[model samples]
Target: MLSGLLMIVDMQNDFVTKNGSLYFPQAEKVKPVVIDIVKDRMKREYDLIFTKDWHDPNDLEFKRFPVHCIKETYGAEIFDDLKFIIRDYSKINFVMKKRFSAFYGTNFDDILKNLSPKHVEICGVDTNICVMYTVEELKNRDYDVVIYENGVASYDEKLHEFAISQMRDVLGAKIEKWRSFNAQH
Candidate 1:
């Protein structure tokens, strides 16, 4: 078994809250599980990170979603209920993101490289998009990866299931539940 980090995706207010333009209530629904996972990781002395969508309201992405994550905006912060204890600031780096994919134009990869965790357990919003890209990047780099199915939520169940299914069969990732951490694959 390899050491791991919980790479939480963008669970920001803009894309998740009901009042936000690109709301995904489902995203809010699975948040507790994600938080629980982080809490568990902390107990194991593993890294726990959250990716923030720190964007300009005027950016191109707003043209498509109409929601924003501008700096200092309520929409830019992590969801209120999902906040977990910070075991160590060094292990819990928050990557500010401008686009849907947290990897682009961000030192997210560098942070992960520094941590050198062999397995990355990803969870959070938009399973078919950001989550998929993150896992793909990790796979390309030959990093061990797993996705906690119960720890994430998406706008559509089909896309969510399809994305994980494809990742499992094609990307060679292991898809399991939030509590799956306690068991061996």
Candidate 2:
């Protein structure tokens, strides 16, 4: 039985790979770490959930940021490196979000409620933005949350550190390095 869920937020090509419209170089650097976490989890019984920024071409969010992850585009797809590992398509939940917070404008909360995972391990790109919002929502909903520090990254180094500290201190999340987090599980 699955006791927990591994929530991979915004690990799409646009955020984690080179030549993407909104690429974060730091995100690319953590790909190996994220991959290791996912691979290790795949060998276990936990559920894996992947969230993608499935924005519209004319999305209002484009006003503030560059066009990215337009639905059905290469940028909207998961990074090629991790694509094949998503073998259990039926068990994997793919949440599509138009906004930064996965809970907003989506059925993420409903899905979480149904899964009823005891713990939710969150890891992905833009630690200060999308990942931060998701962590806030998860905590507000009273879910046990753990963040893989090494598996998440942000373009801004300072913001990333601040977000991690906030998630730990303010949101009551347990932050652990991927290696240590995986070893115990």
Candidate 3:
């Protein structure tokens, strides 16, 4: 079994694209870093797991945030920049989520039980919301987590910084520059 998991969370068009309704403004800056990490991790044979914000048009989440990433819409698709890097669609493990936390109402926990990686490395948008919530759950389950500082971004700078601090300080996650470590088996 693959010894580690690389989670690319919420890297969908609606969150990363400029034309997206709920676009993270700094998403473009983080895109290349994310892609590079993905490429590097792929070469190392880490299990690649991606999470998408798949929601119904009437999802309750739309009440708090703008309507976006509705299931089957172009906006809900993976970002074009990241799509090309996927060499085998069958090998990719996709978790479709409706809430902020990927583990919420999803088979993510079961997937984790099967993969049982030594650690989980994460990258993606909305550092304070989706990313943070997911990390919180992972930590709750006692998974060693590493958050790629350059590979994650948010629309709000303050919230982003706060989330990073909480993930590192409180949640006990390692916050590192992307690709700073060698691949582990």
Model 1 residue 167 CA deviation in Å: 1.5
Candidates' TM-scores? 0.88, 0.94, 0.94
- lDDT by residue for model 3 (91-132), tens: 479999999899989999999999989999999988999999
lDDT (Cα, tens digit) per residue for candidate 1, span 56-151: 657887667765778788888787766534533456878887766667899988887788888888888878887887788788888788898988
Sort order, TM-score high to low: 2, 3, 1
Q: What is the C-alpha lDDT of each candidate?
A: 0.78, 0.89, 0.90
lDDT of 2 at 24: 72
Candidate 2 accuracy as TM-score? 0.94
Number of colliding residue pairs in each model: 0, 0, 0
Candidate 2: C-alpha lDDT: 0.89
Ranking by lDDT: 3, 2, 1
> Lowest-lDDT window of 10 residues in candidate 2?
176-185
- The deviation in Å at residue 61 for candidate 1 is 1.3
- Residue 103 of model 1, lDDT score: 79
Clashing pairs in 1: none
- Candidate 2 residues lying further than 4 Å off, grouped into runs, are 180-185
